[model samples]
Target chain A: MRESRSDRIFYMVNNIFLFIILIIVLYPMIYIVSCSFSNPRSVTSGAVWLWPVEPTLLGYKTIFENKDILTGYTNSAYYTICGTTLAVILTVLAAYPLSRKDYALRNPIMLIFTFTMFFGGGLIPTYLLMSNLGLINTRAVMIIPGALSVYNVIVTRTYFQSTIPIELLEASQIDGCSDFTFFRKVALPLSKAIIAVIALFYAVGYWNSYFSALIYLHDREKYPLQLFLREILIQNTIDAEALSKGQMSIEDMAARQSLFELLKYSLIIVASIPVLCIYPFIQKYFVKGVMIGSLKG
Target chain B: MPDNKTYFYIKKWIDKNWQLTLMVILPLSFIILFHYVPMYGIQIAFKNYRAVDGIWGSKWVGFDHFIKFFKSYQFIRVTRNTIMLSLYSLIAGFPVPIILAIALNCCKNIKFKKTVQLVTYAPHFISVVVLMGMVIQILSPKYGLLNNLIKALGGEEVLFMAEGRYFRSIYVWSGIWQNMGFSAIIYISALSSVDPTLHEAAIVDGASRLKRVFYIDIPCIVPTIVILLILNLGSIMNVGFEKVLLLQNPTNTEYSEVISTLIYKQGLASAMPQYSYSTAIGIFNSLVNFFLIVGVNTIARKLGETSLW
Candidate 1:
């Protein structure tokens, strides 16, 4: 049937509205990329608008030369890798047993895990516990306390229950395959998609975390990239207050200030690149994870 | 005779399922150590905890810390700020994603829809620190994008971050920008599962696209919407602690201080940490959150079919 004029008008208007939203979302991202490439002076002078003005690599060069940023990058990488690995392993170990129908204590155990999601010991007690255990200001502070997530366990358990058949477990058991062998040889291999989803969730979480470090860590060398970014991007705004105190020459101040402005843009892009790079490849898995979670698990 | 029989049954169950028992041991220990241990340590809230005396040895000061928190001047400010910010975010941020999901569902062009989805979802992955960095850059009075636009339009530049009044709007809107796309995914999937025949039947009945969305699409997704709304209501006290802390400065502290940040400052960041008092404040916050979730869940169960439990 040929479309009515009113229906056509509706489609046209809807598309335009969506297009405006598209611009609203894309503009900041594009402007950030453009500002990162623009010359420091041009960036500070507001000459760069939608694209690079007198493009240069000085911002990235300055970032690369900063020792603190490099140390932070290495520390963040170490934390992400170790934390994700531990979290995935622990989540799977918890989820699989809870998924089994024959597991005698699944209900109470699951309740034990779920209760923590809504209520916790709060900050002071957790901190005191961490300190009492001698984890303060150590590398273990980054990984150990946050190894298992109850939400991920529930999601992964739901995946296992829906996708993995109990008949297969019964058959394997009849053939003398123990539960350990079945989990190692059969369940893990078949559940790669859910595993990938859980791993990505944990990896992104570990990469973006800074609060634990802020509260627990006192050493600069142990700081994550986010802590460093906080210092540079947010705390550095205080330097303007210092500038009014006349701590440096005017010319030197202006030059240093411009460089810091450009560096902020570059750092935002550089810091987000790791997650953004892998996002497209794993986007479907994330959608699947969310869908599985939304189900009444 | 009954005790012996019960013991025998327990032994047989453990023997038969010992592998499952072994699988849970490590994770169970982790939960006990990390989660349950801290809960046991919550007794510090009632004690005048000293490093030398330790948690157990400290003198009991029952309800003193909680009373102090209630009577303190900072209490009202932080509580009001927390509730206002959370309510503002919920009221403003909740509807955008539902509208976006509905709009995306209405569009028939596959390529345009896919592009919109991809670009919108990109910001959700950006970390909070970087997001605040971007916000600061865009809102800077000197040499910032908004400032530049204002100057070009013959308007005066405003210090967006420094001012107290702009804090809630900035926090809520930036949150909506970052999360709207990702949050819409669940609703999008819910819409996709909607029966096409419903729309076809509506079309046959002379319904417009807008009318079809109202009559068929929305009613089909109401359960999903209700479940999500319940979850959001349950988390009203959370208020995105890290982002708020990152955005807070001495100038904006009056508007920006929330319970979680206050807890951090008093317990960890202060020169002389007030461990017991901070713990008391934390307990109060958690109790409110717990009651809020339970109360909301109860209401939801009574009024609707979907409840978290």
Candidate 2:
């Protein structure tokens, strides 16, 4: 309970340490942003300042000039929007039915869903199932298989059960409101916080998805921006022998490698900025949602 | 009562709605088909699988793949590296968010706190591929900021990505950097729910910030810590394979060949497609994870506290 002089010094030092951590966290992102706006030569030569040295829009220009990059962005935007809408709608529908206390089958149905959170058939079965469903390579593949997340359903159902008081529902029933009417007017209106959080989660999941597209999507035309950026960054960092027994000449290889290295950091910023800009509004809700969802049953 | 009649009427209505029934039916099928069905293929580890012959037709070869894996030269190295890296991440990465949340809680400067939270949370949404690319750019021996900093500090440059010894440290620490802030948000939310009256009382008693954090803040969140730790332990086998796969080269393969990557190489990356072998390895991995979760849950139950059940 006592604050000695050393304790005061410790508190000051801790604040300073927290400040240093803040810088460590922010520096990479700031560096990437700066490099994206810098001239290519400055970026390639690693002579760019913490702020852009030349302050040019050339990097952005170069990225936009590539037709594949533009298509990739469009495809990613398309999938994220379509996918999040379907996912959220399906999740709410499924969760609402399961949240009913008097639903005779609620316990078994909930168990069936919860069982999946622990176990799975791993990747192979999932892949086979997708193919058999004839969903492979279609835009539908991006949305359908992931249309309902069990975890998201549980969170929504919990929110409905715990936060939406039974007394409110009873009052609505006394007012002669139908089940759908109560859900549409009262429940959904009260659920904006959880909905916002879940929507962000689903949006981020859809946006940052590369692994699913890697397996299910065969056509490059359908690749998301993350996959496009992935190929540019990691795919280009391969050994020559590993590629095709030295097809590339020394000079060409060197030039290609240089572009790959220079573009890597810039690409991170380009891919991340849209999602990053939206974070501040959703930031407060994310923690509350995750804690309530995670720490509770 | 009218309530009893209403309840019966609602139940009757639900029974007749086939469309609603199909909602449960369709999604339930997805889980069963995708998640439960392939569990049958786990037996392939004890069999010699033939694609044309199928799972039933595959010849039983009891313990053969397991023996082969155990005796294989890469086995000990991969297992040891995987366990060690996971354990290290658990030790170092788990508590970072807890500490960070506490630090954020102690800060009275709301502006400074929010700025720090925003900065820290940014890295989480950055994909593993991009994060690794950033890591390589910043740790490259020739031009990296870290190496340059070391040079400025009168130390030799370290090839962080190339050296096996440094690989786990880089992986774990970078992991902490990416996730600690995002993970802390939950704990911070939990901290907020702690009765402010407790903090006020401690302040009146002249409790130092460190004392308040250690005695009051941490204890308030111990249940959260325990639940998260148990869940974490449940999925220890799932090391983030994509990051490791992206970062690894032949030079660093010794330290980088975790289970998922191993499954990937066997399944899709081999000279010959060994789907059966990969499936076997994957099954082995899942079984271990299953046992680990069950074991921890049992212990939690025995300890007379929260269990997943």
lDDT of each: 0.89, 0.77
Best by DockQ: 1
Question: Which of the CAPRI classes, incorrect, acceptable, medium or high, describes model 2?
Answer: acceptable
lDDT of 1 by residue, B1-309 (tens): 469988999899987778876887789889888888999878989999999998899999999999999999999999999999999999999999999999999898989998998888889988999999999999999989999999999999999999988998999999999999989988998998898999889999999888888999999999989888888898888889999998898788889999999999999889999999999999999999999999999999999888887
- Assign candidate 1 its CAPRI class: medium
lDDT of 2 at B10: 87
Interface RMSD of 2: 2.8
**Local accuracy of candidate 1 as per-residue lDDT tens digits, A69-93:** 7888999999999999999999999
- Model 1 TM-score is 0.95
Model 1, A255: alpha-carbon shift in Å? Answer: 2.4
lDDT (10s digit) by residue, model 2, range A1-297: 455886687677778878988988988778777777765456656676488877766445555666667888999899989999988887877777677786566788788888878777666545545665787888888876777789999988887787788998788879887667777898888888888888988888888877778778889899888778776776653333322222223356544454445456667788877778887888787766777776565
Candidate 2, superposed: residue stretches over 4 Å from native: A1-11, A237-260, B1-26, B40-47, B54-63, B152-155
lDDT of 2 at B47: 78
